[model samples]
Target: MTDRTPGFATLAVHAGAQPDPTTGARATPIYQTTSFVFNDADHAASLFGLQAFGNIYTRITNPTTSVLEERVAALEGGTAALATASGHAAQLVVMQQLLMPGDEFIAARKLYGGSINQFTHAFKSFGWNVVWADPDDIGSFQRAVTPKTKAIFIESIANPAGSITDIEAIAEVARNAGVPLIVDNTLATPYLIRPIDHGADIVVHSLTKFLGGHGNSLGGIIVDAGTFDWSKDGKYPMLSEPRPEYHGLKLQETFGNFSFAIACRVLGLRDLGPALSPFNAFLLMTGIETLPLRMQKHCENAKAIAEFLSTHKAVSAVNYSGLASSKYNALARKYAPKGAGAVFTFSLKGGYQAGVDLVSNLKLFSHLANVGDTRSLVIHPASTTHSQLDDAQKTAAGAAPDMVRVSIGIEDKEDLIADLDEALGG
Candidate 1:
């Protein structure tokens, strides 16, 4: 609104896109080919040497994917972005750049069950350690930091629980420790809260969710705030050290603000081999165009459903931060003032069996493992999403046996409430 620039809605549709120069194609054309032709040996040399920027291989970059990256970067107000095969891949690419063997990163105990598993098990295999901290206790984060700690990771709004994290407070902790704050803004898309604006150094997304809106595609992205001092204290070698592969070029010295994103692409994506397809990128871009509209409806329906459940005799508790009674309500107001996001967990008075029954009996709502769909979805995280965790781990992550998670959709609120009423036998 300040410099008379395009509003979010306008940027969503027009950012990073222009009329096709060759055929005037209005829609983004998927460059499905695996490689791009170079002008000559010098052009090829410059691209491969990292002296110039252009598409070399689909495994690293593509025209369609680049558009999605730029659009997301613009939305998040980041210097640059890199699209990946999935959200997990995006996190992996970011960590691969920062962490070395025996290094540790502190993370909030409450997170998506999949991310918890990924950070706990997969990262251990890489010789990288994960130290847990309670997001509710700022002192817990301070205690978790050590000399080897390289970063702090948290969700803007945790999945299933719908708990809102105080990103600014945690960012202060990271700043004091001289480490980057990596925020998983998957549930709270840029429309609701841009993590970078709240002091995050790197923002990651599960494009499979709200960013893609439809459940039709699997994609992810990492937006670089381009604010971190990678060369400070010489902690991030991938950015500060000269690379033998690129004729001893130091990425930070070369790219300046966007160096981290460029490192993720040329170094991580190229080697790890988790590239997003041009087709999926096209699908995600289409979904983002309607993000503002769908997200508003989602928050509206979620609030209505949360209100109804809170007063229901069969419901014991609801974890929606949008509710005034929620412990996270103030933090939600500070961070995601738009809404606390659509995904939240609730417990039934009937306990675990009742939770299972409610999921099974839902008529209009789907029982599935995925969220952020146009259609209402319900699942018992104890039995599905967080099934891999032990009892203590599950409880720590807020997936109790009596809990059922719901991803409220952009559907008719009346129909959605009616379905729940019938399902609960009211």
Candidate 2:
């Protein structure tokens, strides 16, 4: 290869990887062991003290997981990244790193149902309060800020709802507030949009979805843009202040730009103990190698399905940003021009009963709670994923009772449209 930087597909396959140094194996080998042997007493001390970077325990880091982290970081245009057991685990680690007890964070109301539950309930137990804002109203985010606000969170392409958030606008709000903007780019994936390029300070992903395209592995990642100055406001004690665990060393001063990623790995991952297994890391890496190809097909099929649903008499509305009629269509063009992503929500004129009948009648679409799979999947969010929330909360989350979510897959577009047409009583 020439000095020219590799393209997305090339980097997806080769970034952060080389033939096995010891065995010369072409594929990434799984370092399945639980511990790594240090060279000597000083080496062991250096590893423990954060003075050196090498594997010590599988719980914090592993050779296989490191490759996955580096690949994801490069894909997202981030300085560094951390891999975790699941997407929720990744969120927990990042929140723990930035938030102290009694602190608050602002998040867009439209997000994954599981995330809403995690932020609203589980985080509250830790004294971390979530202030919700409407993504459709930029001023809502502005009004939600407080002196205790630590960060802002939003999904690039929100799950189920298929809304495209105005990431740059929110980044400005966070910038003016002296807080970082953390975007979960799970649905859009790096193949479609890179949040950091639009002024986001950090990006997170549930690699279990599109990144692991086959849906065979569970994983999540946090990518540090390395742009935020943790020491500027003195608000983030976890990074700005001295740490007794590492001999009173200040993380921001030592690690500079990538300090936040390091802090998540050493402090949060170490204590939290949610480690991604090496075998799963290997599977995710393989899936990523074909992400570009798979995402293209997924988007093409979803656009066709969305268009089909819009014209049908029985359909009340389609929430896909790819559709010209969608309120988020303009935002989708600005943020993700290639396509508006595959996961989207639509409602039937028959209301709740219609949604239940449509899902049950669809023979081709597998009814499931998951999205970003290689095969088409469907779910009634109000009855399943958002079941824990009350009616008001469900409506706020875009999971209205009449709505049905479909994660269009890499299947032939004609077949997908045909199946939906038949299911809709064509």
Candidate 3:
């Protein structure tokens, strides 16, 4: 049967999936087996020896997970993708595949609190250093680049604060340095922004967010654009050089454009073992079908809330890219032209106490840590998410003591505004 090249919506519903040959099932069935039966000893040898691609174990790959991977790659306009157990796991997998001991990467200072901890503390043990650069200043990225710099990392739309990065500018710096630009597209997703289209070599996402909209599954994905030439300068020995473990096969030579994804799965996932569950993959696939719809509504609701917050007497400042006054508005227009996304922050006039009271008073918005959910959610970052960071670090990360992060949902704008009105003592 000839595969139809459909539009985005059509591809979302049918990509990397077809009716099961055995049962004629239209829905993707979870291949709940740990291992697949091989045809013969030679076939098994070829699979294990990297001569052929087939599922050897559930920990490395699975059929259900493969659908999710393919769908995400198609959505992000990447050559291939690998699904991981969590967003953090995806980051670890990418770093493990690319970075060696004493190598470094440049990252935007404004990032998720958990990500900051992961880069600063956890990755340090592995001898991977992160050079923090201000995303607002594109020149900082170029200045931060060193000989040991392997990649440039930034969020398309930063978490909590919702600052937008100038992806093309940063990618230019990475290109000049001969390093791949890695973008965490978790907030913007592919519906609003495809980093690969903006010159990002690798794009990562937390599927637990908008991609898995219902908050039922925890998953992540790393998508390779397949544009970067790993062998050009021999910066990445793992991909450019021969692998002794895989029978002297070089990834760049064998997989061609998709060498990065192959390395991430074969080496990173093979060693790290952070594969997404088949059940989670199925849930994530279901969620992706409605991604365009959900994302549109999310941006709409978020814009309304941000506007309201900006005008309110109690609000000291609003940090949404949709706002004209936002520092990121220009970049948001260039990169995320569809929308600036749902996650943003607003600071109250009363500082920390007011932030605490707003959360305590809200009736509709749930006070939770997670973002990109179907229901509206809020959090006082200084008291909760960034509590571990000291005053200086918190301010540097845009997590002020008075700031409250809101993840707007597909709810009635009037109702959401009214809920915040009462909470802010309107």
For each candidate, what TM-score against the reference?
Answer: 0.97, 0.97, 0.97
Residue 227 lDDT, candidate 1, scale 0-100: 96
Q: Which stretches of candidate 3 lie over 4 Å from their true place?
A: 1-5, 388-393
**Which runs of model 1 end up more than 4 angstroms from their true locations?**
1-3, 386-394
For residues 73-184, write the lDDT of model 2, one tens digit per residue: 9999999999999999999999999998999999998889789899999999999999999988999999999999999999999976889999999999999999999999
Q: Which residue runs of candidate 2 sit more than 4 Å off their true CA positions? A: 387-396
lDDT for each residue of candidate 3 in 1-426, tens digit (9 for 90 to 100): 997677788778888899988999999999888888999999999989888878889888898999999999999989999999999999999999779999999999888878989999999999999999998899999999999999999999987688888889999999999999999999999989999998999999999999999878999999999999999988899999989988789999999999999999999998889989999999999999999899999999999999998999999999999999997898889888889999998989998899999999999999998998999999998998778988887787778888899999999989999999999999
Clashing pairs for model 1 are none
lDDT per residue, candidate 1, 98-201, as tens digits? 99989999999888878988999999999999999998998999999999999999999986688999999999999999999999999999999999998999
lDDT of each: 0.93, 0.92, 0.92
